[model samples]
Target: MMNFHIHSTWSDGLYTPEIIVREAIKKKMEKIGFADHYQTTKVSSISKKYLKMYLEDIKALRKKYGEIEIYAGIEVDFSPRTNIDELPDFEDFDFVLFEYVQDSLWDGYPLWMLLDLRKRIKPPVILAHNDLSRNFGATDIEAFLRVLEADNIGIELNTNLNYTKLGEFYYRLATPIFERVEEYNIPISIGSDMHENLELLDDVEDALSFIQEMHLEKNLKLFLKEVGERYER
Candidate 1:
């Protein structure tokens, strides 16, 4: 199994990167990525000075545990107060995750703004735990898919319970969007959004089932291929 939304002590998570690596290896995970918080908020974001250390720590873990693939990533909070322009360049990381891009309650920046920001960042950018069904359900599906394709961005299937509403996962609620993804062959990412729980390191059984139901094998294979290529470099 593969997951790319894990958080460790570098941010607000309870565990450290070493512990996370140990847990993922114990679970027999094929690959995992560390995406600690990078919010502009002073209390929530990782300090700028720690950024280099964070990447180096994950890279070291990647080498030590050659048995499993490990990636360095960050989860950026895109809100009205957060300036995508002022954010640090992320070209060196394996991937980047954006959260609350269209949630009004959280003062999220719109998808259009994110599309513009996507052009500046170098690594793969994914929308994290978004309620897309609520945010983009009424918009033009084709247009949305076009922007995603043009920007080379991926949508995340978050397996975290906090994103569930009406007793269904957010991804399930966003059927129209994903249907278009299938039609357009856009890449998709899966993240358990693990914060404090290492026991559920790669526990994404439900997400796996959903991917099969949606016939997203080709998309997933493409994503994995890109990740492998990035690692090779």
Candidate 2:
């Protein structure tokens, strides 16, 4: 399995990059990524000065482990209070994930602001663990689709237990959007959002089940192909 959202000591995670790499290899994962936090508010965030060190560590892991793909990424918290100008350039990273986007938690920034931020960032922008049903389910679905398609932003199927509600995952609550994802040409990103455990690396079984139930093989393949093209992996 492939999981692009992971955390390490560079951020709030308990394990270091080398330890996480070893664990991922043990799990026989096809691909894994280290996406440490980069938010301005979070204490776990990696500062701009340490960005080079984080990238170098991931680069070293990439060279050391030829059997599995290691992607270097960062997870940003999309909050209204965050100063977008203070964030570093994202050209060096393979991808970037934004959390609390359009959600009640953290008083997330509006979708329009996120779109504006996307225009400035160079890497692919993905919404991490978004409460799609709560956020987009009540809004104008068509306009939302138009913005996602125009900006080429992807949404993630986060396999975190907290996302479960009423005996179903949050992504399951957003069937309307997933049903028409193909129509809008929007990509779907899957991740376990492993913060401290290497064993949880690529543990996206629930996400896989959701994709299968929704018959999103075509969409999944499209996302993979787009990522490959974007990162030249």
Clash-forming residue pairs, model 1: none
Q: Where is model 2 more than 4 Å wrong at Cα?
A: none
Model 1 alpha-carbon drift over 4 Å, by segment: none
Tens digit of per-residue lDDT, candidate 2, span 1-233: 89988888898889998888888888788878778988566657787888898999998888998988888889888885556767776888888898888787678887888888788887778888898889878888888888998998988898877777887778888988787776767778888888776667878998888888777777677777766665564
| lDDT tens readout by residue for model 1, 106-172 | 8888998888777788787888898998888888889888878788888889999888997899999
* lDDT of every model, 2 decimals: 0.83, 0.82
Report the number of the highest-TM-score candidate: 1
TM-score of 2: 0.93
Report how far residue 140 has shifted in candidate 2, in Å. 2.1
